[model samples]
Target chain A: MEIKKTSLNKLHQSNNAKFVEFAGYEMPIQYSKGIIEEHKFTRSHSGIFDVSHMGQLFIYGDESLTEELEKIFPLDLKNLKQNCSKYSFLMNEDAGIYDDLIITKIEEGYLIILNAACKDKDFEILSNLLGSKFKMNLDNNRSLIAIQGPKSVEILNSIINGVDQLNFMTGNWFNSDNQKLFVTRSGYTGEDGFEISITNDKAEKFVENLIEKGAKLIGLGARDTLRLEAGLCLYGHELDINKTPVEANLRWAISKSRLSNGGFIGSKKIMNQMQDGASQIRVGIKPEGRLIAREKTKIFNDTDKQIGEITSGTFGPSVNGPIAMGYVDKEFSKVDTKILLEVRGKKHPANVCALPFYKKNYVKGVN
Target chain B: MSEVKFSKEHEWITLEGDVATIGITKHATEMLGDIVFAELPEKGSNVEKDGTAGVVESTKAASDVYTPVSGEVVDTNQAIVDDPSKINEDPEGAAWFFKLKMKDQSEMDSLMNKEEYDKFAKESAS
Candidate 1:
């Protein structure tokens, strides 16, 4: 099957982007500046990412859709305030995470933004649960662009108003003339940023305008490195159908109210993991040497006993060294613990570090 | 006088008397994209022709560097190991990966010269 193209596909080509097939879409892996340059630029200044392939669906109904949604996910959606977004998991009946999603409470019902690769299955899962009461509208016509860096607000504020006021995880639809833009102060890069949802016809122009204001166009390669540095979980890498939220260090997304009430799908197994502690936990690993211990590299302890394996690994431009994250035996999950990663048949010493390899610089609460 | 030869795997070997200097070709470096790390075989190690001698890692993935001929690793380039990006800068010269004392000079006859390698690279790309 031919790969699908986003609205800004032509723009990426014109900007000399190196295209790679990602999640069934012809996405840019990096521009002419390369991944290392793009990664560093996003950390220092700002970069624009075309994440339009992500699933953006709207579920609407007269009565709140929370009751129906609660049965499928692990979050208490009933109390989710309007315009506030909560990052939660779409869990299966057996407690495995189906997919991680962002559900923002809208005026009519809710809008769920999910992983691009899992969109089809996730859509089916949602439609099956609330199809009778809620009307699920898949928004394919809208393009999602993430503007991230210290200068993100300055770049975006020039085109629209009041976007700078939106706090992290809060979204508001801004209207100018006839075009409506939904801007959210949330991103994967662990930096101050905003994700703007715009219509297809205006998407290219929107990106061009941002470029004119000095936002470099970043691609999937830098996006992966940036998110990895931030300790954010990528769907296939850090999460899968077999891993529970507790194992992936995502218990924070499971609200206390939901845990106490005990009414969400997979609540039994999830609650059990929360109470008893998971056998394996995700931890960050910093390779002691220059060699990068990529995904699937085995992890070992001082005695050379196999402890775990790396799920995602890369040379972190900001960190100035190779970094990785993987699941390890909970007994060896403490920070600063010594570990060895076998890369290409050679063992390299590594240190277990705290998550969010880089400090988050989010602009919170109207800052 | 020196003569350069290419392997099917995109490694280049330059022969000068009994010693051969080896590194990945520019074509290989371009395909790998922004090489971040290089693992070279230790000095004095014996390597078989077409055997995996080292590894090159990019941000996206890792690839093995195969020896084009049987040889004893005489020296490894510590500079390229210290800064892998040097390979991207000058893959054929300053970024040379290692030096090997050739076991048999006749192996050069089986390798591709500059002209033949160019044609092979084009064919492989297409």
Candidate 2:
């Protein structure tokens, strides 16, 4: 297959980005300043990310559409106010996650932002489920740009004008540069930020305007460090077909009302897991020193018995230490529980720690 | 102090009498990015030519640091192990990985000089 490039490919080139093939797309892994510098810059200021490879699935329908979606997702769509968004997952009958997504209620129906790798499969699943009763469009004409960090609000609001009023996990449409942009107050970096949906043709100029406003373009390397520090899950790593949302420690995303009724797809398995408790559960890990336990590193108990494996691990720039997230035996998933990580044939001490190693205030509560 | 010699593995070696100091070149550090952790060969250990003598981990990944020539490990730099960022900051100077007592000094004769190494580095990178 031909490697795909985003509309901002030229802009990334101008910034001296080092490209890497990600999910079949030629994407920047880091710029010339490198991952550490780009990470620090984002934490101290603003950083823009090009997420155009993700699918922007707009399903147009009315009240019936909301009712039908409730049968598939665990969210209470009827009670959800317009413009409000919820973090959710698409799952199989056994409750194994297919993808983690953000779905927002719009005037027409709903807008779902899906992971790049799983978008096609998710669209197919949804199409088969809905059976063509609702109009679905996995629009490729739009680009998703996320501006994150402390200074993101001020920088993005300067151009969009009304984005500051949007609360976390909410979105609204606004006219900017004679084009309609769907602006949302959400981001993966756990900072007060916004994700702007705009036309592909306007992406380059729009990003240039952000660079002019002091927001530098960060690449996938820093993006990984930032999100890991924030304790957010990446699709293929932290959640996959073999992992359930309950086992992944994301049961909070499931609606309480739906849990009791158990009508959603995979609801039976989800309810059973919620009651029986998953044998293995996800938790944050802090290595004793500077040793990085990369993905697939074996996790062990004090007795040398293998308990689990690391899913995502890295040196968190803001935390100034190594942080990781992985599934461990449910008995060993408590905070401060001692565990051993096997790196390069040597066992090292580690402890289960609370996530979001770095904390910052988010603009929420409006929804 | 002697003229620094380059190895195909990206290590630079400088001989002073029977003791030779070794460190990764600046180009290596540039390629590796911000190094966060380091492990060194133990003192009094004997290593074979081109054998793994240490490990350095950047933010992105972990890579082995190989010894360019066989020797008995006389000393290992604890400074780089204590703070690996120095390897990226001053890799060729303050970040020398180890010092070895030469097992066979002829191993240095096969190494590249500064000019030959510059060409090799360029061609290999391209």
Candidate 3:
């Protein structure tokens, strides 16, 4: 298969980015300043991420569309306000996550942001479930760019104008450069940021403008470190076909009203796990000293019984230490629980800790 | 002290009497960016030629550091283990990994020199 490239491929190369193959696309791993510098830069200043490879799915429908989607997702679409967003999961009958996404209610219908690797399959599955009743376009002509950090609002609001008024988890369409762009105050990094949906042809120029406004381009390497420090989940690593939202400790995302009625696709299994609890649950693991227990590294009990495995682990530049997230037995998932991580054929001591290793600075409300 | 020799594994070694000091080359550090963790072989342990003696981990991944020649481990740098970023800052100087007492002095014969390793490093990277 031919490797794919995003609209900003030339820009990344010109900035001396080191490339890596991610989800079949040749994406930049890190730029000239490297991961640590980029990660820190995003925390202190604004950093731009070229997330164009992700899926921007627009589904247009009427009143009946909301009714039908409520049966598929566990969200209360009837009560959800326009231009507001919610973090959700597309699941199977067994409650296993197909992909985790952010769905925003727009003026016409809903726009869903999906993981790049699973977008095609998600489109097929949704098309089958909806049975052609609505119009769905998995847009390839659009590009997604995320600008994140402490100074993101000031930097972005300068160009787009009126963007600083947006509260977290909300979005609105604005006219910029003679085009309509859907700008949302949300991002993967646990910083104040915005994700902008713009036409592919204008992406490079848009990013260059952001650079002129003091935002720097960051790569996937720093993105991983930043998100890991924030305790966010990645699709292939923290979420998969075998993992359910309940086991992943994301039960809060499921709407309370939907839990009682139990009409959604995975409601039965979800309710069961909610009541009886899951066998394994996700938790934050902090290794003692500088030992890094990477993905698939085994978690063990004091007596050497294998209990779980690490899903994501890395050196968090903000925290200046090694951090990891993994599934441990539900009995051992409590904060401050002592656990062991097996790295390079040796067991190292670690502790189960509360998530968000670095505190989030989200702008929740202005009024 | 003598002229430093390099191994294909990107480690540099300098022999003084029978004690040979070794550390990963600067080229190796450039390849592995932002090192965060390190582990050294135990002192008094005998290591075989080209065997794993230590480990270094960057934010991206972990790599096993290899010994170019067989010897008994005499000293290890605790400073690098305490602060691995020094490996990125000065890998060739203050970040020397370990010192080994030679099991066979002639074991250094086949290793690459500075000019040879430069060419090898360039070819291997491409």
Candidate 4:
């Protein structure tokens, strides 16, 4: 498959970024500073990431759009306030998760951001389900950039005003030199950050401006570690068509109203799992030693019985240890449960622990 | 004078009389990024030329460390295992992975010397 390039490709090359193929795009995995340096910098300072590859879809329709969307997803759009963002799941009939997305309710319609690799599939699903009910507009002329970390607000606030006061999970338009920039005070990294959507024509200059203001250019390498440390689930890893939200430990995204309302797709199976407790549950795993157990590493029980497998694993720089997230039988999924990881034909000891291997440092309301 | 030698897989070996110190080349560390974990072969283990002796893991992936020549492991550097970052700090010197006693002295002729290995490293990168 031919790989696509973002508008900031030239800028990344000029900045000495190491390129890697990701989601059909040749993206920078890291710069000269390397992943560890970039990861640490983002924790203490600020970092800018070119997330243009993500799919941005705008849904427009009449008053019935919300009800129609709620029927297709396990989301509670009724209480979703205007200009607020909510994380939701796109589920199939089997109660399995098809994709995960962030939906922002606007005045006229809704803006949804999804994973890049799942963009075409998501659009096709939306069209097939609600083709006559809503108009789906895929925004390709815009680029998305995320400025994240502790100093993100200070760095970005220096260029655009009032962004420092934007609460987490809130989306609004800010005018900059007559350009209406849609920004959300949220990010994948467990930090105080903002994701800005700008036109392709102005993306290069905007990124250059952020770098000039001390936002170091980070790549996908550090981005993975940051999100992993935040305990955020990547679509293909922590979520899959065969896995339900309740099994992935993402029940928080489903509100109480939706569970009781019981009209969404796969609501029956989802509620059943929630009530009876999922057969398997996702939990954090910390390996006993320095050997990092990567994805697909099998997990074993006390009697050496294979119980589960790791879905996502990496060396978390902030945590200063190897951490992983995987699904295990609900009976063995508990804090401080001893588990064995089969790595390279050897059984290494590990323990199930609380997630978010590192503490989240989000800038919520009044924080 | 004893001199440094290089293998096709980017490992480096330096012979000082009967003992040979082995470590990865500077180019290898740069390509691997930050070194997070390292597993070295145990002392007194018999290994063959181009055989996997240890493993070095970076944040991105893990790579096997191959022995440049057949030998018996005399001493293993536990420092790199205790703190893998040392390999990134000084891959050719203080971070030498292991020391071995060469089984056959004739094997040294097959390895590339300083001048030849420099050109080889540069060519392989391109």
lDDT of 4 by residue, A252-300 (tens): 9887888986888889988999999998999999998787989999999
Interface RMSD of each: 0.7, 0.6, 0.5, 0.7
Query: Which candidate, 2 or 4, has the higher DockQ?
Result: 2
Candidate chain B TM-scores, in order: 0.97, 0.98, 0.98, 0.96
Residues A1-367, model 3: lDDT tens digits: 9999999999999999999999989999999888999999999999999999999999999779899999999999999999999999999999999999999999989999999999999999999999888999999999999999999999999999999999999999999989999999999999999999999999999999999999999999999999999999999999999999999999999999999988999999999999999999999999998899999999999999999999999999889999999999999999999999999889999999999999999998854
Q: Lowest-scoring 10 consecutive residues by lDDT in candidate 2 chain A?
A: A358-367
Candidate 1 per-residue lDDT over residues A1-367, each given as its tens digit: 9999999999999999889899999999988878999999999999999999999998886445777777777776777788899899888877888899888887878888989999999988877877676688889999999999999899899888788889899898898548998888899999999998899999999999999999999999999999999999999988999999999988899889888767788999988889999999999999997878888999999998999989999998889889999999999999999999886667888999998889999877675
Which sequence of candidate numbers ranks them by DockQ, best first?
2, 3, 4, 1
Regarding TM-score, does 3 or 4 come out ahead?
A: 3
For model 3 chain B, give the 10-residue run with minimal summed lDDT.
Answer: B103-112
A225: Cα error in model 3, Å? 0.9
Model 4: CAPRI class: high
Model 1 error, position A240 (Å): 0.9
Model 3, B1-126: lDDT tens digits are 888899999999999999999999999998999999999999999999999999999999999999999999999999999999999999999999999999898988999899999999999999
Q: Estimate each model's TM-score.
A: 0.96, 0.99, 0.99, 0.98
**Against the unseen true structure, what C-alpha lDDT does each candidate score?**
0.90, 0.93, 0.95, 0.91
DockQ of each: 0.80, 0.91, 0.89, 0.87
Root-mean-square deviation of candidate 1: 1.6
Model 1's interface RMSD? 0.7
